[model samples]
Every structure is written in structure tokens, then in C-alpha cells.
Target: MGKPKGRKVARHGGNPNAWREPKASSPSLSSVTTAEGLLEKLQSYMESCEFVVAEKFANRALERFPANSRVLEAAAECFTETGNITKARTCYLKAISVSPLKGWRKYLGLAQLLEGQNAVLQYTRGIEVMERELAEVAGPAQVETPNVPSASSSTEKDTAEIPTARDISNAYLSISELYTTDLCDDDNAEEMCKYALDKAMMADPKNPEAFQQMANFFLIKGDKEAAAQYVKGGLTLWYTDHLPPEQRISPENQQKVGVDYEEGSGMPGLALQIDTAKALIECAEYDLANRLFTEFITHSPTDPELWYLNGFSYFLHGNDYYPQARSALTKAKKFATTPHGICYDIIAQCDEHLESIAKVLPPTEDSDNEEEVVQTEDSVNRPEQSNCEDSDWETDEEGCEDVEM
Candidate 1:
């Protein structure tokens, strides 16, 4: 079949003269060269940083070649370098608009100038265009290594370096400090705390700080049991650490552990330790909380909040530290009195949680079940059935046994 009129043919299947050539151009290379010479002089003036001289030359060139790209670009550059960004940007846009091929470079230059002035939105849009042009380049992209580390790798290294219960604890506590001290947004503050907690757990599984942070997060979220478990875990670690700073006490022993206290940042890391202890207490990790509070007290001997938290932490332990709790409350009382004092308010509210332990405590007479029954003797009780409700209360059943609270 014959090809249709004006139909194209595949290269190898058709006559080679199918494509036509235009007649030789009237505007010869010499004429363009003549115009380029004028532009070069303008460019030289612009490069010399003499805006007046550059503008003069560009105006003269434009009179002869009103649409000359080089003249426009030179004038724009002069204005741009000499602090006339508004005018420079307008000229650049015009030059690029005059030629589709120059669009990307023009936009890139404009973006750079805008960025210098902090015009983020415009600069970012220009950057997008520039990147698109880069992607279109017909070659393998160069692999450029940044002088500074990549953010991802840098963060990973930072996370890796914070290994150890103390380090993890300090890290989380500092996050809290930033929230409380730097007045960061509450949501962001919480996020920062959570991030540190995740890192702390990865750094040291047994780090009390990690557990305590979880407890605090949950407590804030109102999950009491989960919070309690975390608090317990943290305090447990704190207790273990307290077993003996002796292993870590001797300089020789410290050297063996690879810890160089002498090479420290001189500013007492005491504040961090104190804050960690406070977190422990906040999550109701009482026993270890007391230990840490005591240690801090022994060291500083005058931190008012330490005294209050110490006494309150003991109070939270119920009978375990009834005497100590009273003592702490007394000391804390000296420094505070509002019904909502951090120590007193917490101590009082803790009474509700403490009531649970109080119920099952002090095995009642004739207690038969391995699981002790703790009936809420107070109004705070949830009104749930006690094991004492067995038929044995009135008659023999399941080996009736009575217990006293």
C-alpha cells in the first residue's frame, strides 16, 4: 500500500531527503558577534561591580539590539549584585521568559537571590524547578559528599553515643527540662520526651530512666497500671545502682569501668541526677525514688524541692515509710503549704491509690485462700465483690475463713 499524503516514514524505510532544511539565515554569525562584543563590555563592567558603568553599556547595547539576552542579563546582574534585588529579579524573569531554554537557570538564580533575603516560599518553589531540570540532565548524576554529616547518620551517631543508664536518664530528663525551661509547645515537649525515652530504652534496656519516662508518659495519658509498671522498673534499677557506688567509687574501679569522672565537665552533673530522681518519684517509683532523693539530699543538703519530693516519695510507699513519710511531709511542710503543693498534693492524692494496698494488707483471721481478699474499707473502693462474699460468710463453703484488715 502507498503511504498517505503527509504521512511520516520510519528512518530506515524512507528516502533520506524527507526532512527539509531552511534557507541560510540572513542574520549571519558576524552580525551576532558584533552584538556580542558590545555585551562583553557591559559584562566586564558588571563584573567590575560598577553598576553605573554596566548600566550605561547595557543601555547603549540595547539601543541597537533591544531584545539582546546578554544585555538584559548583564544589566540584571549589575542591579542584583548592587542591592537592587527587585529590579534584578524582574529583568531575570524577563530574560528567561524570552527563551524557554534558559528558564531553569534563570529561576535557579532568582531562587538563590530570594533565599538570601529569606523569601522561603519563593526560594523553595524555585529550588523545585531547579531540581526538576537537574533530573532531566542526560547523564549519571555526580555523587556529592557533604562536608557536614548527613542528618540521618548524624542522628544515628547521636543516639548511639547515649549508652548507659545514667546517660539515658540524663537525656530524657534534659528533654523534660527543655519543655519546662525553654517553654516549648506542650505537644512538642511531650514528643521530645517520648523520643528521648525511646532512645534511652534502646541505649540501656535496664535504664530506670527509660522505664520512668514511659511511666510518666502513660501517667500523663491516664493509664495508671502501665505507668505504675514503668515506675517500678525504674526504681528497681535505681535500687540496684544504689547497691554500691563503691564499685564505681574507687578511681581505679572507675577506670576499669571506663568512666573518667575527673575528665568531666566540672559543672556538677548533680542537677541531672536530681531531675532523674524527681522523674522516678513523679511516676510513683517510691523506694528507688527515696534512695535517689536521699543521695541527692546528702550531696546538696539544701535543695528544698528535694526534701519535699523525698518525704512525699516515702509517703507514697504507705506503711513502708509511714514514719519517713511523716518526717518528709514535716520537712516539706516547712517549705510549702498550699493544698496543691507538689509534695503535699501528691501525697494526699496518693492516698486513694494507696488504699488498694491497705485493703489486702494485714491478713485477716481465718484467711483461707492463697490470694488475700482486700475489701475497700473506705468510700474510695470500687464496690467490687470481695472473696469474703463466698457462701462461707453465713455458712460453710470453700472452707470458710475470715480475715481482718
Candidate 2:
């Protein structure tokens, strides 16, 4: 080789733990001439969370190559890690000054460090920086300089000046959340939300973030129709609409066909399905929830909590699923461990479900529901909304109102 690379020359004494050495005095600025050597040291310090050491390496690099925007960017990260946000802000500004047309990333970081009107201002500046950078990269006369690598060359995440659609979506979502959720400025928040949706649609026609934000925004404004429209726009439509009876699982007839999952049992697929089903129930997608619950119960039939939720969701869907609802509630009551009002509620629900079926069902269908009526009539004839000992309802699980109904 004509010349050796940036490897260290043999010192008088070499230690086995050279790479593992603790933070020490800064290297001489002239000694670390090449950006690669400085970057390697800085990256090592950063990976080890030695922010001060990383800053020292970056400063040394900057002293030799003042125009090295990447070194300045590295220094900014180190400053941020050391909790010196003001210094970090200065470093970012220097990075942008060094290469105005290639500093969108630094601008993005600078924006994150600000808040309120300042953050909005910074974000607006960052958008302009990114647009300018993209225009420069796409210009006809653009030239590649091999002498100095771009800051983005440090990693794939920082490689692009043109912001990805997801990136734009995230920026919009952040600003919207800041205005709507943090500041509680509904008017400005709504404007931001609309702009975000437009940006998201421009980025990708089917972006989920746009739909989710629209759904939440409309839901907050009490516009259910608009909420429903946006909810349907999302890629996942499982929670959007009602499922016909045929879509629900007949768990009683599912003859040990699937696997059962445990609560935090560490079984991967089962937990995922159960969690998905549980979320569906919360979103009032009882049809899909019922199917997931039934499938999970088939595998893990002994779970009293699952039984309870199955019964509860069916009850909410009305008397069409009354038989299954009553049966599940009765089963849940038997399996329940706590001798609390939850038991009473389940029993009461069973009674109400039976009464409802008696009205609409044929005379022969009345026998099963009426028979259950006499069995619990003497002991727990309290209505579904029990007037006695309301304290029992107070301690129940999620969605259980603490009021004495």
C-alpha cells in the first residue's frame, strides 16, 4: 500500500484494553486530521453513552475540519445526551451553517428540543430546510464530492434530505398532538389535523396515521359519522363495523380445535390473538371480539375472566345473542373466584337475558329461559341494575361504572 490508513502508530506501550479504556484527555486536534478517525472515536463514546468524551472527540474533529457538518452533528448529539440542550441547539445551528442545503436532520432535532410557539416555529423552519435540501439534491447541476462524506453517511436513517411520507405524517401528528392534546387549542388543533391528513394522503393514499388521527379528531368533536368514515379508511377494518352472527364462533361446538393462551403466559401467538380480541371488545366490535374470545376459550376454556368478557360483550350486542350470552354468564359465575358483586351482576344478567328471550322466542324456547328463572328467582331476583349494595359494583374491572345503578 502507498500509504497506511488512519490506524494508530505503535506507541511505547500497548495495552490489551485499548478499546475498553475509560474516558481520558482529548486527542490533539492536528493528530486527528481525518474525519473517519474522529468519527470512530466519537461513535464509540456515543455507543457507550460517554457523552462528554464524545463531545471532546467531535470538538477535536471540528478544530481540524471546521466545515465538517457531520462532526458538528455528532457534537450536537453528545451535547443533547449530556442534557445541555442550549449547547446542542448551537451545535445544530453550526451544522446547518456549514451546509445550509443539507441540514434537515439537525433542524428536525432542533425542533424537538423546543416547545409551544418556539417548537412550532422550529418545525416550520425544519420543513423549509428539508424542502430546500430536497431541491438541491434534485437540481440538475448537483455534484458528488468524495473528499467529505455527508452527515447522512453516518447511518441509513439520516441518509435522505427528502423527507419520507411517514416522516411528514409523524411531524404533522406531533404538531397536532401538541396543539390538541397538550395546549387544548381545538381550533388550531383541527386545522393542524386537517393539514396532517392532507400531507399524509399526499405521502401515501392509504397511510394509517392519517385515518387514525381523523377518527380521533372527529370522535373528540362528537361527529360519529366523520369518525366512522375515517375509521373505515384505515388498513385494519376489523373494529369498524358489525359482523353477522355467522362470523362469531360457536365456542360450545368448537371441539378442541385451537390452542389456548394464558394471561402473560409468554405464549406468543395466543397472547397476540387474545390482546387483539380484547382491543376489539373495547372498540365495540363485539362481532370480531366474540369470534376471538370463542377461539381463545376453545384453547383456554378454564379462564373465568374470558368467560365474563364473552358474556358481557354479547349482552351489549342485544337479545339476538341472548342464549349464548346467558350461557356464558352462567358459566362465568360458577368459575369466578371472588365472592363479590361481580357474581351478583353475572347472575342478574343471566336472568335479564332469559327474560328477554322469553318475550320474542317461540313457546317451546321459553322453557329453557323460564326454567332458569325459577332456579334463581328465590335467591337473586334483583334486576340487572341492582339497587342493593351498590358498593359491590364500585370494585369491578374496567368499564364497570362505580355508580349504584
Candidate 3:
């Protein structure tokens, strides 16, 4: 009777052990103890474009790890995305102050927020830091791996934060851009830009950005042929077979085309492709540009800029492609007006192109009327001439009389 009074267990219809209370999972964001954990969570939010959530998480991380350079940098990225430039600048400055020589990215981040000489200065400093850091780990044989530290004793310093080759190359590319733009009037602008580009190529010979930058430099110098060559070089890095006929790599040569790029480096592939296509258009490679722009349109159907570019490419091609150009520009105009609601200059340009096309390609009815009018005018104003047969007969009779005499 006492045994019967023991607690009873409920069972499902099939297996009694089939389901049990789910075990507590790993800690959530609220329970994240380490700065690294918080930074990871923050990055996840940022990647998802959840800027508000990222900003809040970043603020929390800053409070938890006030002196952590990475945490500060992460917070700064959050602020920058959320349009809080003041706080972003402050965080970047603090991060630099905390560990001035350790992170080159912080300097670049701050540089992006500034302009003109100030931006140039920051970019230069960032490049210097990157060079120094890279030199430390230049040779694998010279470097020694440290023992893995226990979790409790590990710090951010124990983490490997080495900059990749592409990072250094892109840094130089940024300096090259600054020299071409904000510092264009400086005495050594062209020379500095060339130097930076050379360093970029040396740092990463396979970098598309370096090639594209060189192309841009040549284009600015009005050397279109050189620009086109560099554009081909850049495009070859990613789209070897998709390039124009003159630039496509043969099967045998494809093996020689070695790209030294990480999985995700510099700009997105689509953007780089777009840039190369633009360069192609600039270099009068209209057919190839149109092909790339068409593919891009399929991927980004509603992108007004892409449509405009496709239209521009067709428009520049020749009179035969006017119709296709008209269709693309019309779509671009519609997208720009309804959704984008800006790019008035682009809209104007589209209108101008449409007008030019209309002038060149008149309506069928009007052209038919013009043709009829021309035919009628030609028939009404037909020219008259003397009969050569009568002149020949008179001349022949005179010659016969002279012979008889």
C-alpha cells in the first residue's frame, strides 16, 4: 500500500523516453562573458543589417570592455552604420589611443570619415602601420607559433590578427585614390599615386583592385590604350573566359592564371565586374560591356544605375542598337522616377539620349511621308538633256559630204 503511494510518471502513447525537457543551450548574448564573444555577436548582427540591434549590443560591449581595442572598433563600426558619425569618430580615436600600433584598420576607418589632407594623413599612417605589422610576419621560417593559452589566461593579444596580402594592397590602392582625388593638386600627387600603385602590385600581384587602380590612373592621364590593357588584366583575375575575345585566356594559358585572392577580398565580385564593364564602355568595347551589363541586369533587375549603364553601352554602340538602347533607358527612367526618386541628372541624361534617338530614328509614318514627298519632287523636277543621236546624225552627214567632195 505504501509503495502504491509513490509518485507516478506520465508516458506518451509510444516510447516513454521519446521526449524529455530540452536541455538548456549555450549562453545567449546576455550571458556572453568574453569580449571576443560579444564582438562576434555584434558582427553577426551587423552582417544581417540589423544596425539598431548591433548598435545596442555594441554599446553594451563598450560598457563591459571599455579598454578593449577590438570592442571599441566594433562599436565604431556599429555607430558608422547607424549614421552616428560623431560617436564613430570618438570610438575610433579611443581605439587608436588604446592600441596605437596594433590595428591598421582603425586608422583606415577614421580616414574614411575625414576628407582632403586629414583623410590622406590617416590613410598614410594606416599604411605605415600595416607595412610594419606585415614585416613582422613576413617570413614563415622566421616566425614561431606560441603555445595555446588556457581560456582563463588568454587575452586579445593572444589572438592572431595578421593582415592579409590583399589588405596591404588595398591600403595602397586607397592611398592611390586619395592622391588622385583629394590630394590631386599636391606637387607629388602623380608620382605618389604611381608609387602607391607600384607598391600595391608588388604586395599582391594578383589583386584586381591594383590593376583597376592602374587602369583608372591611365584613364585619368588620357592613355586609354593602357587603361584598357589594365582593365583586361583586372577582369582576367576573376572572369578569364568571360572577357572579350582579345583578352580571353586559352585553356593552356588558363593554368598560368593564378589569382592570389582570399575567398572574400576587396570589393564584391559583382561590383568589380561592373567597374570593369564601365571601363570597357569607356574604352569603346561596347559589345563586351553590353554583355556584362545584360548579365548584371538579370541579377539586379531593378537597379536603375545598371539599366542606365546597359542603355548607355547600347547607345554608344551604333545606330543599329538604338532601339535596344531606348528600351533600356526607358526602364531606367521608370525605375529612377518611381522607386529611386533621385538621380535627376541621370534622368536628364536619359531624356537627352531618348531625344537623340528620336531625332535619328523618326516615326515610320513620318519617314514614309518624307520618302513619298521626295519621290514626287524628283518626278516633277526631272531634268532634260539634248539628244546625242541627232547630234551624231548631223556630224555623220557632214563627214559623208566632205568625203564626196
Candidate 4:
């Protein structure tokens, strides 16, 4: 029988170079010819669903064009699919070494590889690097598209049904719980805090507590600008609804201070000052917090909680105000560990607060540990904190006081 018309026997398997774009379309294509033959063989095997043979073909391509970005990418992918993570990582590194011109694609692939291996820190670190590198390489002017409103920004749009409000609420709540519970996991704690902030924001947009929680999250992450935004949002909510703006200023200084003030006892004004001072401190607005702290001490210098807060704020400055921190913490010790007869709960809070601050401080020459564990400078969309576990929710009196405002 005669062979089918237009059919030709394949010679030396199909050419992998067939997948390479033309030089006119991609300048990178010119150097890609070295692996064309092996690429063709791999392509043919892949088409036939012969993964083992395809991987073998890819290995051969790597031998011929070890520094070819496309070949290395293909080899990495092949090894990854076959559960050879070590080899896959090596191939990916080779691809990155070959051509650093793939923009975000190379970093994105590396992120995937790191993620697959369950290296959460490494994966997040890769993303951070990619973001910075891509930003640096991007043109001065951004290519703007027509304004398409995001769902989060569209106020008039109906709230999409979450279908799992309780789950989401629990998720955020659980992350908040970690800040109060765990001590050693600053990295996970910060990530969890962000997860909580996002989940809580989705759960209740109108809740000032959610915004306040996010402010603390940013503070812990050392993002002053982001923390300030959330703190401002929370403060706006406080002034607008809960504690009328007038109550924010002291009545005694209303005329002299040239600001609106509550026409009553200074307790409310004192509380507002304390709360605002704490928020400012958390946002790294040390100058503002210091000014407020000076005024607060003039009014109630002996108050244990106020002393604790002032000392805590000072400690947060680290090396910036060592002498002041030493004095403040000494005063705080009088309220915390000394036999001043302070409330047990207040004393406990002081101890916990001091411990947390001490752990983060730079160690002295005689300290046992040289290295300190700190939160990472990376973002992560962590899994839901609660995952719909109903039994996790419990009433806590400590955080309840803040809710009243």
C-alpha cells in the first residue's frame, strides 16, 4: 500500500526548536537554536503522554544548552512534575542565571517552586524580591487603564454574600488571639495578624475594632505608613460616633488649647488622650505620643496603667531613647513587680508587656542569646485562622474595655 498523501516520516524526532519564537518576534529566540533538536524530541514525547521519555529528552536539552533559559525552565518543570524538587530547584536556578530578562515570569516560577516545597518564608521572600526587582525595572510612568472600580472600593454595590461570615470572623479572631498567646513566632504572628486584618475587614467593614486591630498589625510589622492609615481610620470612627470629637480635648484647656472640648470631668478626656497616645505610639508617631505622654503624666503621673503604657512606648524606641527607657521601665517596675499593691490584672499586663518588649530589644554583651527572632518583611495570604471551627470563640474581658469606645 502507498503511504498516505502529505505524510512524511519524522526525522530524528520532532525539533523542540519548533516551540521557539522567531527572532523577529522575540530577540531571545536567536540564542535558542542550541537546544532546538532536544526540544523537538521532548515536544514529541509530551504529545504522546510519555512523561518519562519527555523528561529524559529535557535532560538531554539541559546538557546541550545548560545556560539556555527556555531549556532550563522546561527541565525544571519536568523534574518538578516528577517529584524531583531538588533537581527542579537547581534547574530553575540555572534558568535564572541564564537570562535575568524574563521580567516577573522567572520570579513567579521560582515562587511556585518554593511554595510547592512548603518553604513559606522562602516563598514570601521570593515574592518580596520579585516585587522590588520588577518595580525597579518597570518604566517611570505606569501604563494606566480605564478606571474599572474594584469591588472593595465600590460603595454603592451590594455586599456580596460571604456564605461563611462566622468562619471568616473566627479566622480573624484567631489571628488576634495569637498575638495574645504566642511568644516565639514573630514571623507567623505578623503573617497571621495580616490575615486577621483582611478577614476582619471583610467580615465587618463598619467595625472600628477591625481597623484598630489592623493598625496594631501594621505596627507589629514595622510598617509605619500603613499603620498610620489604619490608626487614622480608627480615630476618625472614634471622633465621629463613639466619643464625640469634643470629648477628645480637656475642658480645662478648651479655651487655652483652642480646640473643642467636653464640658465635663477630665476623666473622659484623660481616657481619650491615653487611647490616642497608644495609637500614635503604635503607628511610630513618637513625637506626637511623647507630647501626649508629657501632658498625660502631668495629669495622672501615679496611675499604674498610664505609667506602664508610657514605659512601654519608650521601650519601643529601642536605642533612640535609652536613658528615658531605663527611667520609664524603672517606674513601670514599681507598678508591675514591686509591692505597690497594684491590681493583679494590671500588674500581669505590665509584666506581659515588659516581657514582650524585652524579647525584641537588642541584647547586651552578657546576654545568653545573640540573635533575635523578628517578623519578616514580607506579605503572605495565610490560610484562614479558624477554618470554621465553632468551638474556638470565647469571651475575654481584657479586650472588652476597648470595645466600649
Candidate 5:
């Protein structure tokens, strides 16, 4: 039979394009040549958690821009994140050598890589550089009349790379933490910590980390109320102050508020936010922690660690929150099991929590009602009810006789 005029003949029984191979897309890194371009590419890879690819690209960047301080610093950051501590140290050293007195960040980076006195010395150098740089920049303004506003101050606000008081404060905060951790055995550790913390707050009263560090210090001293107050102070800087009363009431609403703040401010990155959330959790601020975790989960739904943290926060809130804890833990276990084999540890922890919840909650009314219904049906069908009654009577009589004896 002849085909109809409007009918189209099938090519390979369906589509002609089906047999064609897909074209591979070129990598964006191919176009990058300048130091800035390479840094951006390196950062994009690092942010996406592509450490292997980031390492390869970082090495390529180093080969191309061997003496570029910015490139070296950025590559060092990538290496540090990927656990190549030795290479990261080398990169930081090279970066400092290339621009010794210009940037303070490389000193801080190298300091973080070292331990004990060496780390303290590096941190001190970085702090000195920061102070000197700030004073030099502010020198011209000090020379002018006290009432006059500096032209540079207005212009500097738009520059993201310029170190500010907050940076100096954060450096001091780092020193304070080191005293509490790596240098705790020193006779002057507590005094040094307090001094550093005081410097941090004085340098930048608005710096949230200063408040957080103070909270930690107070917590170490076993002053929970003071720690909580400081934690609240930290939260006020970037979180609570930005929200309306209505939005502050619930975690979901608070998460929305956080998202809006993040979009507008762009100051607190995910890591900082996570750190703040963890601080809240540690200070027994479960509501705030849960809200922050909700926002984090919205941004990175596949992050099992966040899910686990959320669950743990609820668990610590007490038995009343067990249901929410179970749900979050289950989600955490599910995500931890994917693309990799099931995480037996997560499974075990989740099972343990579930057992705890089971122990706390009474048996469901439905089960009890079902049992009663089944028993009633069995009694109706069985003609041996009298025999059961007789057994009960005999047991009661035996008990009575024993009591009398």
C-alpha cells in the first residue's frame, strides 16, 4: 500500500539524531590566563568541593604565575583545603617572600600551618603588619582636623580586599583561641587569652567573632549565663537584629530571614554562618541553631553533616523534641548512605535514638484497641471461657490459701 501524503516515513524507526554522539563541552579554565582569572577558577573549583580538579588547576596556576603573590596565596588556600599542608606551607612562604611587607594574610596563613611558639610568632608578625598598615592609612586623616572626614574612608568602603578593624580583631581572636587550645599549658595562657580577647573587642566592637570568642572563654570558666549572653551578642550582629519579631518566632521563618540577610549583606559566608550556628548549639540555643541549620539545609540539602547537627541539636533540647530529632536523624542517615555504601555508624546511632524514643513514648492506642478487639473475637468464638474462668478461680484460691498459711 502507498503511504498517505501527510505521513512522514520513520528514520531508523524513530529519530535520525539518536545515532549521533554528544559533543563534550570545553572547560571554562581553558580561557583563563591572567592571575585573577586563574584565582577565580581555582576558587570556583574549591567552592564546589572538586578538590582533585582544584589541585591540578592550582598547580597549573603556580606554573604559570610562579611569582604572583595573589595566585600563590589562593593556590595555598586550595592546597590547605585539600589537606596538602606541606605544599600549602611552601606556597604561603613563597607568597610572603614575593611580597613580604605588603600583605598580612600570608603571615596568618603560615601561622595557622605552624604550631607552638612558631605559630605564635607568625601570628604576632601578621598582627604587627595589620596594625602598621592601618596606622599608615589613617595617618593622613590624623594629620587633618579631628572634625574632617577622610576622602579615602568613603572610597575604601567599596574595596573588599582592604583590611579593616574587623580583620585585626579577628586576628586577635585567633590568638585568643590558640592560647585556649595549643598553648593551654603555658603559665600565662589564661591571662594571654583574656588580653587578646580584650584587644579583639577594643579593635572592633562590632566584630561578631570577638563576642563568640568571649563566649568560649566564659564557657571555659564554667560561667554558662555569661557565655549565653555573649552568644546572644554575637547573634545580634548579623542575625537577630536583622529579623522582625514575627519572623523570629519559628525556625522556618528565621531561616527565611537568614536567607534574606545573606542575600543583602553578603558578609557572613556559609562557613561563618555554620560556625555561628554551632556556637548557638554549644550554648544550648537550640531554637537558633535549628533555624540556622534549616537555612543551611535549604542551601545544601545533601549535606549529611548538617542534617546530623540539626538532629543532634534537637536531641539535646530534651525528650519533648525527640520526634523532630528522629526525623532529622533519619534524613541524615539516608544522605550518608548514598553513592557510597550505607554508613553503619549513622545507622547504629539512628537506631539507638529510635530505641530511646520508643522507650519514652507509650504504645499506641490503636495497638491496644486492636488487641482488645482480637481478644473479644476469640472469646466469642471459643466455648472454653468457663475453663479459663475456672483456672483463674483456682489460681486465686491457691493464692488465698498460701496467704492464710
Candidate 6:
């Protein structure tokens, strides 16, 4: 009984509103068997490019293990990726409520979901979480490392995997950017920027963001020299791949920076800048390292550490950019956001380099008629007659490795 072939019927009028088939309902959480099974299935499905199936399992898993922090955390990441901001926020909240110390990740994700002052509060909360977690990790004022057999690989692994304050800085940097970018139209944003920058340094002194922001702090305050030095370590950079002669660590090159960044090579991240500088310095390529530091300072323009590293690189860079180093180190002293300690040591070293340079050089034209200058200043590692190897500068660098360049 088929309808007439070319029925001139008004389809819309015939059926004013079409009836739709009912959607299939998700499985009951109670019957999902176990959280482990759900998690495994979720992972397996995800790996097999079955995201719809994976999401279904994740939804069920959340229902069954509502208080499982891992499940909540995973949900937060998944929700975020899928643009489910509301669900992501809810999941992050549950995860954080259950484990505040481990909520830095969630805080960052949650911050992105909020706008204006609310986002700032979330970011602050994240910083606080990191502060508390770092304190907890440093529980014993000092850890007594007993001689353990190499066979105890598990113990070694435990030691290796333990989170440290430095480990938290990258997160702090990300949160701080929300303020700098003014995504939420922050009030007293500069202060907020500094707040996170301070914490970022406390978490990891060598953090590029912290260094860059600190430079910005100075720039915003109208101190261009300090700002420039903050990022560039106050040295005038010289581009070259070859190392200058060791004898060049004199007043003539005291303000010089040397580097060779590849053209069109995009700027490096904070960690990459630091690592590359460290490697260059270790290999006696002070000029190349100085160039890298300059790039960071040029790009970041707010990191106080870049200023310090700039100065440090100059000290060992064999360029004798001690004047710029002194200028940079002096400016760095203004911002004591952390107990990095190197600030003072570097200042002392700068004084030494300057004094040594003055003592060795023959009387200059300007000072020929002046009284013999009294050798009042203290000296650090003095240069050898004719040459001082940059290797000598590597001695005080060990402890700072954990902090920054």
C-alpha cells in the first residue's frame, strides 16, 4: 500500500512538528563494575582513537568515584580540552577540595575559566598551594643522606621523583602571565604581576618569567637602564661565535655582550635560555652565552635573573664587561624578592673584577696627574698575568645550578 508516486502534498503542513527518536541513555554508574575498570577502559579507548567511548566511560567513572581526586583531575583536563568550561571548573574544584596541596594544576586551569578579579583570586590560590606544598617538601630542614647501596634503585627513584619548590615555578610563571596579559582587565595589575613574580622566584630563582617580569617592574617604574640591564644584564652585546682572547676581560670590553642567535630562529623559552646559557658557559663559549642572555633580556625584558645571568655571563664571558655587570648587579639589588644570596656574592665579585682591572692597568691618561689610588677595594678571583681562563669562574656556579643560570 505505497502512497501515490508524485504526491503534491505540503510536507511541513502534513507533519507540523516531526517526532524524534529517543536518544540512548548512558549506563548506570552503580553497574559500571569498578573505578579501575572504567579508568582502564577510558585509557584504552582514548589510545585507540575512540574518544566518544572514552568520554562515556569517564562520565560513568566520575559518577562512581565522585571523591576520587585522580578521576576529578583527569576530568578537569578532559573537560578543558573539550571546551566544557563549566564542568572543568567543577571537576577542578572537587579535586582541589580533596587535595589542596596538589591543586596547582587545577588552579591554573580554573583561572582560565574565570575572568577579571575572580581569575586573579584563583591564580593567587594556586600560588598559595605551591607555597604550602614547597614548605611541606622541605619538611626536614636538612636531609641526612646516608650511604645507600646502588642496588636500592627504588629509593633512588623515590628521591628523583620527589617534587621540589623549583618544580612548581613553571606553573607560577603560567599563572603570572594572566595578570601581565590583562586578560581579565586586572586592577593594580602591576602589583599582581609582581606578586606572582616573587612567588615564581621563590619557587625557582631562574624562572625566565620572573626575570622578565622583574625587568618590566623596573621599566614601568621609568628606570630604562635597570630595565634594559634587568633583561640584558646591562651589557652592550657583541655578536660572534668565536671566543675572545682571555686577556680581553678588561675595562675596554666591560660593557660588551657577545652572541650569535640564528636568524629567524624563534625566541627560546625561559628554561631553554637558561640551559643553553649554562652549556655555553661550561664549554667556555662566554660570548655565545652572553648573546643568549641578551636575547632573553631583549625578549623577556622583565626577568631580574636575566640581569643577574647577564652579569654572571659577563664576569666569565672573557669580555671584561664588568662595568655593565656592575651596573646590572647593582640594579638587581633593588629587587630582593627571594633569598637567592647570589645577589650579594655577585656584587662582591663585581667589585673584585673592577678593582683587579684597575690595579693591573698602567696609569691612564686621565689619572696620570692624580695621586696614586689607594687599593681600598677587595678582590675576587684575580686574572693571571697575560690571561685568566674563564674556567676559574665556574667554581661558584654549582649551588646556583638548581636556581638559575
How many clashes show up in model 6? 17
Top-lDDT candidate index = 3
In order, candidate lDDTs are 0.49, 0.60, 0.73, 0.52, 0.71, 0.55
Runs of candidate 2 with Cα error greater than 4 angstroms are 1-33, 44-67, 135-162, 236-283, 288-405
TM-score of each: 0.32, 0.51, 0.66, 0.29, 0.59, 0.44
lDDT assessment of candidate 5:
0.71
- In candidate 6, how many Å is residue 388 off? 57
**Tens-place lDDT digits, model 5, residues 1-405:** 111123343754865455443346424445577766777778888998988777777887888878777778888999999999999999998877766655688899999999877888888888887776677577945533224232222322233155788888888888888898899999999999999999999999988778888988988898878888888777766675346767474765565445444465635567766777777787888988898889889979976678778888888899988777867776765654432233345545655765676688554565345335534543454333223332312222122111100
Give the per-residue lDDT digits (tens) of candidate 3, residues 1-405. Answer: 011122335653554334444237422446676887888888988998988767777887888788888889889989999999999999999988877767788999999999877887887888877776677778746644444322222365556377888888888888888898888999999999999999999989989889988998998898989999998877776665454455555764455332223456443466677887898888887887787778778767977688888988899898999888877877765554431123345556777887898899764664345435534543443323323343321222122111100
- Residue-level error in angstroms, candidate 2, position 201: 2.5
> Can you write out model 4's per-residue Cα lDDT over 1-405, one digit (the tens) per residue?
111133343676775456443455221222334465666666766777777867766776776666666667777777777788888888777765554433224444564565322333333343444444444346525533334333121221232222233334433544454544442256565565566568678765655566666776666667889988876675554342223448644543443442124465222244554666688886777665665666667666655556656766776667566445544544543433222122335444545655555566553542212111111110121122323334322123331122110
Using lDDT as the yardstick, the better of models 1 and 3 is 3
Q: Rate residue 149 of model 5 by lDDT.
A: 32
Q: Which wins on TM-score, candidate 1 or candidate 6?
A: 6
Tens digit of lDDT per residue, candidate 2, span 1-405? Answer: 011124464577676466355335644434555777888888988998877667777667766666667777777888888888898898888887766556567777877787776776766666665555555567835744334444434443355446655566556666666676555655566677567556656755545556666666776687767665665445242222233444424543243233434356322345444544554454566776687678768766856567767877787777777767767765664543232334445445555655665576443554556455545642463234444364434233452431111
Q: Name the regions of candidate 3 deviating beyond 4 angstroms.
A: 1-33, 48-60, 140-154, 242-267, 301-304, 330-347, 364-405
Q: Which pairs of residues collide in candidate 1?
A: 364-403, 364-404
Q: Candidate 5 vs. truth: CA RMSD? A: 17.6
What clash pairs does model 2 have?
Answer: 260-299
List candidate 5 segments past 4 Å from native. 1-101, 141-162, 241-256, 260-264, 363-405
Instruction: Give Cα distance to truth, residue 294, candidate 1, Å.
Output: 1.2
User: Candidate 4 versus the native: TM-score?
Assistant: 0.29
The alpha-carbon deviation from the true structure for residue 216 of candidate 2, after best TM-score superposition, in angstroms, is 1.3
